[model samples]
Target chain A: MSTSSTPPAPPPSNRISGTAISKEIRAELAVECSSIKSTVTPGLAVILVGSRPDSLAYVRMKKKACAEVGIDSFGYDYPETVTQQELIDKVNELNADPKVHGILVQLPLPNHIVENLVTSAVHPDKDVDGLHPLNCAKLVTAQTHGGSVKMNWKDLKSIPFHIACTPQGCIELLDRSGVEIEGKRAVVIGRSNLVGMPVSLLLNHRNATITIVHSRTIDAQSVVRTADIVIAAVGRAKMVKSDWLKEGAVVIDVGINSVDAPDTKKGYRLVGDVDFDECEGKCEKITPVPGGVGPMTIAMLLRNTVNSAKRVCGI
Target chain B: MSTSSTPPAPPPSNRISGTAISKEIRAELAVECSSIKSTVTPGLAVILVGSRPDSLAYVRMKKKACAEVGIDSFGYDYPETVTQQELIDKVNELNADPKVHGILVQLPLPNHIVENLVTSAVHPDKDVDGLHPLNCAKLVTAQTHGGSVKMNWKDLKSIPFHIACTPQGCIELLDRSGVEIEGKRAVVIGRSNLVGMPVSLLLNHRNATITIVHSRTIDAQSVVRTADIVIAAVGRAKMVKSDWLKEGAVVIDVGINSVDAPDTKKGYRLVGDVDFDECEGKCEKITPVPGGVGPMTIAMLLRNTVNSAKRVCGI
Candidate 1:
């Protein structure tokens, strides 16, 4: 009677493994890529300005991913001194290239290069990054029209218009994990166009009541605690605490921040906006930083490229 | 208590009079319209597909407003038997005509006619109603870029792109009333493309945190109660009760619903989403139905027409 059986053997961790899911998606994309290659070879043109180490690493990873999925990757590297007009000209050249199904411009361009002008220069059909104004507008229109339309995400081959990679990845993670988005309260902790805003729109399209809390938000913690699904993309390292989340909330961490670490080989460690260690057991399903949204982003990008190829080839 | 003092006079009702503000705006627009007319006549083409009484009444009101602002109004009347192709053909003709600076297709076309196809047929530059996909996309792009750019709504001559009229009207009301939008909690009920979604984006661009609650929202009342600014656009009469609001919240009621009113010869009266009588003293400022939002919408449309004329005429 006195034996207290190890506190009922605490329930298993509910961590959502984006790495495994992304692997599966990449395998599927590989098959789709090969099939599409028969009619038209899928190609992605990645434009990188200035050799920021991090940006270079991201580009390499993307190129590697494209190769893995059997898609063609073309790299266009520019010097730091390149003019904005030069960049726009390159984008226009890529836009006219029928072989280039998807064009991606690496972000954080040099100060002199106006980002929006360069990004907008890409043709909407080939703008796989989905930052083009037309694509964003289409996303907004989808939200209103999607209210009555029942979309089967499982059967989804390609959205006619491209969506931003990270946000699309976040949704893919949620959907593949068997999470029900309809009627859920989803709190997005940033409002960046690339991630936060688009992701919130995607969630709303799926029928999730959304609350967008930003830097100016008052009592952000309380607002977050009310969410059934929490998407943290504010770029703050470990800013979210266990107490800030409701018990069993689904957490998707999109932030990747580098923090100093004396013991690490790289002299720093990468952490997400969420405090993973503290939030582990509290969450019903949570994505780990490096292995979570990072891999999925690349996967979605590959998918977009393949989709664009199919559309261009009339598959 | 000394002298049995009467409870301090209830603070004066802070009604944000959209009617008065709209009149003021219309006057300003009239001046602008005349100035633009010096170079080229500003014309708005109102397309009426069917003979629905309400649609006819709205069309007439718009035409009257255009006249009041000294802009030319052209009517295109078609019976209910009009085909979608004919409407598109007419819109294309108006799009090509320099005289038609703005083209508006009155909504609620016959069931057979696709609404989006007809509305999208108008060129973006002449889409005074601002329902064009390109215009909606521009509005979204503005939100992302507007973060660092300080826009003076007071001195705003014309937005480079057209925004949905009702949403722009809501913002105009708030700015004119001097209700602080930045750093406020805004709750938008409904997520309609015409009013709710765009207005929420407008508020977010102004630095307010936004929460969108739709019909599927759980505990919608509590979510709304947290708002400092409540925009009720759900189109349900008297749905937002006084108790569902934060004390001293600013309310913009966008719903115009008809309710039974036996005393009136019309047999019905127009009401907004917010319960006016119960919410009057509770709100710090609130817009009234019939006189609020409604007039401002018409005013915004005329302003858009004049703006389009100025752009087209290169004035």
Candidate 2:
């Protein structure tokens, strides 16, 4: 057989793209933003304590996301030497600002500053990150009481408050991708507060049979192989191998890890916990790295900000 | 002739008695309570908004428990028609009173009043029931961050805050009975905020491979049969038969359902979710209803009250 006779394989394109879905969500939020009856615009205040490259980039991206949705974005950048009290004062100021409906303090704060003290200073109503203790408590309460687990942005009246952005983003991506979450066997790999734990609760709220697989979980591979939906957020690069997944399972990769790539200009490339190439032809749906959960996070942030503003306006 | 030869089965006395275990815990708490350096006594203030017989009985038991430990107990009884503000005001009054170190609001408040509002009004440190939003958030945070999962009342510094009484009691009962929880295959039935959800989280925190089986779970019996430790909190009478349990599995029955008993004074007798009669000689350990988790809740409440008083007095 001649080498040229073999047809070139088609591009690997059967997957959920967070960038495209996030754009759709942003467009929807923009419409809601313009329709607000209140004279005050939906505003987000971003506080960046240190000038770390990744942190600055994230803040800039969040501000741009705010602008795209017709929101008024405010930025505050503090030096690495900023004291804890100074940061908390800024948060209190933002809390009192009527125009600023949401306040977000970027993570990985400097060593001298206590992150919890600063995060808790933001008023729950103005907390867009949804990392506030009160917000976390509300989620626990809602989940325990069998409250609204469905993500219906149109029906904000039922939800207690802003949900954690990353988990909310994961759900938005899954729902918008047309995945049926209810009554499905869903497995979440990892149990971090940031992604794994809250996402499992959200899935359970939507009536899915949830099993959380963490580091100490025995027979993790076998447990994951039974899931109709698999969420990987363990933060290890390509940890969830192809063989670990069930056939035709809907996969949502929430990990963003950097691996060595000598050919790239930065000498590093991003990859999800799942080996994307390995999952190419097996899963019914999967999310790609860099453009998957990353984009959806900011979109949810904007949506939460708009929701906060709407609540303030009583609209 | 066969029944006579069997010698009547030696009376199933191997099971853990919550009443006996709770008595031990109360004894330990009493010793700690009497050694307090503060001049004021540890006090618990319970607010009962209605005349529900169950609620009244629960409150009366709590006061009696407090008195047994040389602690002060206060009660606030209000009509069901009391407004939300009135209840909240009473909570605030108790919160400010130095004499009252813990405040508990009876559950199933009048339908007219929002329960969350009244629950949140109780100060977090003084929330003896551990149902306040702050305390619930702390539990979620601890579980997510790998905090202390073991119940070590003697070493209070390790615990971030008080755990939910029933869940804490479950762990205490197991620990006191010498059932090792670490690295075990644990199955939790039900997903309520009170018992099931928190118990699963607690078990997970202690390095157990946790599987939460709820109403939406499929093949629940098969799933449960794999557990080395089974916690049944589904509130269904005799739902977990012997067939559903693995041989030698340790069982913690949190359910307190009243099934028909025509010969009894109340026309009913309490039973756990587990069919205890069927598991007489099979399981390694089990908890019986009416003398199991029921007594431990009040013991935990007393412990929490003393801890709160210690915190208030900076002991």
Candidate 3:
């Protein structure tokens, strides 16, 4: 048989390393934190109720990060049976405390506590989690001025309000990775308030033509395939397939799901909403699970705290 | 001449009559107002910051509507040179007045006045305009539960918070006219705080897949053509053409612009962002400008006032 010339293999996808970028951001924040120490130390008060193992691990990671960045961390642990009024009272105390620049109440609180009421009780100034209704409203309102204002993400202190950490991290991933956001067709798969909705608003603020597809969207694949940038935050394991993405599209996968992996030590592995192995080659740029948006989220929380401290100290 | 077979003409497009719908809602509100009067009469404080002709006309129209619906209208007119503090103090006074159930500050306040400070001064319970940060936050938070909370537009009293009137009117236009929103592709053109952004959120809350395209959006026409529903809120006159719309798409034109019309006695005529003559037959349904979203805005304001009264009177 005569040998035929084979086509050249496609170039490897550009994998965005959220860990490396997060390290860079933390280094910069460390410098800022040191500089601000002359005036006032940035302090973050983290309140965790009903210590689930995962949440406890997350809080430990956050506190460790705070230490590395030279920020003071205050941990307040509550039992599962703690009353809602007690949590609100603690939040009010933190709001009045001059030392506390940011307050974060861990999510998935005990069922007995009303999440919205507890979250709303945080004063807007110290709402580093950016889950407060006032901060959320600011996020919604900030981008509606017909592209008149451009956000310089590097100047965190300039922003008048805090943005949700995960969503902000998603943007930071794109911004730091040199992905062009303005005027691109961006599809966000999911509509959860914590990530999907706020991220869509942030992308819109950056001048992306945003389409938000959710559980009710018919032919979600077809809708996603039209995007130049795809953000998968649906929290389903490998729910997004290769065919759902447009070739050469930039993807930021915000979902972290545990899937059965019998061969792994814990009998499971963490996967994102996107099928990374299948999608990596097809995407022009893609964020990997665990090393992707997760790291940036903590980095943003530190940045928000530092900025809040600066604002409070009139730096 | 030889006989030739020709295709029959297409069915006529449905022209949604917002004026008629507004009249129907006003009548319903009148009934609600009379019933609420048994406990407490609904009172709206309309604050007009200046004597701009359009602002004056709008204030007059709102007062007339309030009177027709059996609600007391308290008109507060300010000179152009009024201080921001004065306006805010006035707002504070109205906020504390038990007789006032709703406070509406007419938009485009004098340039000297700080609009946000004055608007935020109105207590959230009395912010019928829904511009206050708290109310705006409620609108964003209310929709984030991943389609779990379905908004029944008819049950105004159950919403717990105010939604901006024009955006609310856009949804009412769709709901009243029997346009199915769920699982449909909806494109909203514009990103103004008052209209485009809020309307997109409202549509998202209704489970419609939403795309928001604005000035910075590239290939906006192509993006819009994929939508089953189009909301034209950009202030430009006659910018959306028939070719930009999907076949059988329902369009809600929320724009009211004054364009030069030499033949008219006033040498000007009100038109919408969509080209009415070109798009009317092409659309499955379309709302006319002056008689469409404009009238519905006033109607929703009245509804918000009545709802606030109901909540306050605990009826």
Off by over 4 Å in 1: A1-11, A35-37, A81-93, A96-98, A143-158, B1-11, B35-37, B143-158, B312-315
Q: Whose lDDT is greatest here?
A: 3
* Alpha-carbon DockQ of candidate 3: 0.50
Model 3, residue A239: distance off in Å is 0.9
- Higher-DockQ candidate among 1 and 3? 3
| iRMS per model in Å | 4.2, 4.5, 5.1
List model 3 lDDT by residue over A242-300, tens digit each: 99998899999999999999999999999999999999989999999989999999999
- Per residue, candidate 3 scores C-alpha lDDT tens digits across B1-315 of 957677768765488999999999999999987876779999999999778899999999999999999999999998888898888888889989999999999988876666777788889889998888778877776832222255564544478889899999989889889899989999999998889999999898888999999999999999999999999999999999999988899999998899999999999999999998999888889999878889999999999999998888787
- Comparing 1 with 3 on TM-score, the higher-scoring candidate is 3
TM-score for all predictions?
0.90, 0.92, 0.94
Q: Top DockQ: which candidate number?
A: 3
Model 3 vs. true fold: TM: 0.94
* DockQ-derived CAPRI band for the predicted complex in model 1: acceptable
Off by over 4 Å in 2: A1-13, A143-158, B1-14, B143-158
Model 3's A-chain: what TM-score?
0.93
Q: For model 2, state the Cα shift of residue B87 in Å.
A: 1.8
